[model samples]
Target: MITSISTQIQLAARPVGWPRPNDFATVQIELGELAPGQIRVVNEFISVDPYMRGRMSAAKSYSAPFGLGETMTGGAIGRVVESASDAFPVGSVVLHQFGWRDVVQEDAAGFKVVPEIPGAPLSLYLGILGMTGLTGYVGLTAVANMVPGDTVFISGAAGAVGTAAGQIARLLGAGRVIGSAGTDEKVALLTEKYGYDAAFNYKSGPVREQLAAAAPEGIDVFFDNVGGEHLEAALDVFNPGGRAALCGAIAGYNSTERKVGPDNMVNMITRGLSLKGFTLGSYLDLAPEFNEHMTAWFTAGKIAYDETVVDGIGNAVDALLSMMQGANTGKMVVRTAVMADVIR
Candidate 1:
């Protein structure tokens, strides 16, 4: 029988810098009777992303800040177990944005029905087939305007969007692909698993020197996931007419002090480089194009990806912190319950 309560992780307090356990509170709420056009869903998988950190801050950003004492929201995929809406039937698989909870009751409009593929897991909706993959495709194709034969460099190349960016760059016909990771293992995975032509551990040496050695001829495109030093290095090696997609700056997300930017501002003018920072919210119009290409690529076995899964809703906060600390290989997802049990 379906439970009559919902468990949620709420924001208890905003972090000063790095988030702490006391910053969140786990609470349970009594489930109310479903209203017309509403559905009850049991989340199967929840996504933990770096972007959420920015939302935790009270300062304004592209998205609004999460209200303290309220349930934190993010991407989640669930199975509708009870429904009062004709559009969403019981047993329907759906994806929604009401997350940080194990079960949710919301208007059906909050949910979107997802196709049930025979072999693929629903978790794909939160990763490669989802927004993360779209972010990568958008960065390379639209933001950077990459063309065939361009040499591309990606920072934070082992994480979700980074891994996707590396594969998407190659798929988009980049002549050479290079990546920067925090660890040697991650660097190795970039070259071996993600098909990066060359990869370096930023911790091993200065990024500019390592990148210069990797691509002696210089890069035509850069996908900046880790800003600060990575951005500085990218600026140093960009060829004339190079383009860059400034995706995120995980390096400074939790800093209590002001983070210094790259020192090479003159490179932009001298190299005639174009750099643009983008948020995925502005590019939903490209969803059809992203889905069409990524689906075909995944179906054809041309793209490679990974996920670091943390089990249980109770561990969601830890999963988020682990991901921010670079413990995750690709997408960091939380599996709420046994997949078969939830579906059956």
Candidate 2:
């Protein structure tokens, strides 16, 4: 008698530029009887990332693209209701790949048991303490080779990865952290709240000039999220032997095709620059280190974050595309209806 109403969003059409509402469809589904070793979870919040827009189209990327008519792929954290196995009991929380769904019944082994954080908010798992945090940590520590006293620059400073990167760099003893965001509000938050020494709104002027002003002596490390112009600009401002942790090329996701690579490739030779493309999935082994650092930072009140949450599972498509359109102020999460009414 445990019936679950699941709201599922599927890719209806490939987007040409910006994704229209019609490009996705939200459908309500009925759950069947669960088999042994199966667990049904009521999804609380799902992530909406800039990288997901690429999955909507049939283009080659780090992860497989979503089929023309398939459920959008992402991450979600949920609460288990009816469990057919003892390993996961009712009332336990879990994390799984149940993206854009209200409730899901998957194999018990498919999910990871989330440790309790009674004082901290659950939404932290979808942001600072989750995969997004790990992405920034691994990129900075491993790929960027960041060290204490190094000057850092971050593109897309308002988004999840960018925000986390700036804070982590400061905590690791960076001398300065400069960032670029889309809006004046985000730029202000970067400097005032998130501990960035300097930040600017990329929409206001050329990225190169803005970065040069923020980092007059040049930056030792650049954590790139908004690619294209941001990437091009980083090349001009990187200190000799500086490293670039290329986390995402979000600015070019909506473009028709490849528009421009950095014109300052010559800087790579003269300055001994290194730009590396990285994904969080490739550095799962470093998750323990990231979680340890982030947990302590959160507990000690050293880290800060923001979230732009949209209510209702039906509006998931809008929330998902908003990350690409720069409509989101911080981490974007599609909040399902089960929360607040039942918890708060």
Best by lDDT: 1
lDDT of 1 by residue, 241-328 (tens): 9999999999999998989888888999998999999999999999989988987888888878788999999999999998988999
Write model 2 residue lDDT over 191-288, tens digit each, in one string. 88998899999999999898889899999999999889998898998899999999888888788876878888999999999999898888999998
Candidate models: Cα lDDT each? 0.92, 0.86
State the weakest 10-residue window (summed lDDT) of model 1: 335-344
Model 1 clashing residue pairs (backbone) = none
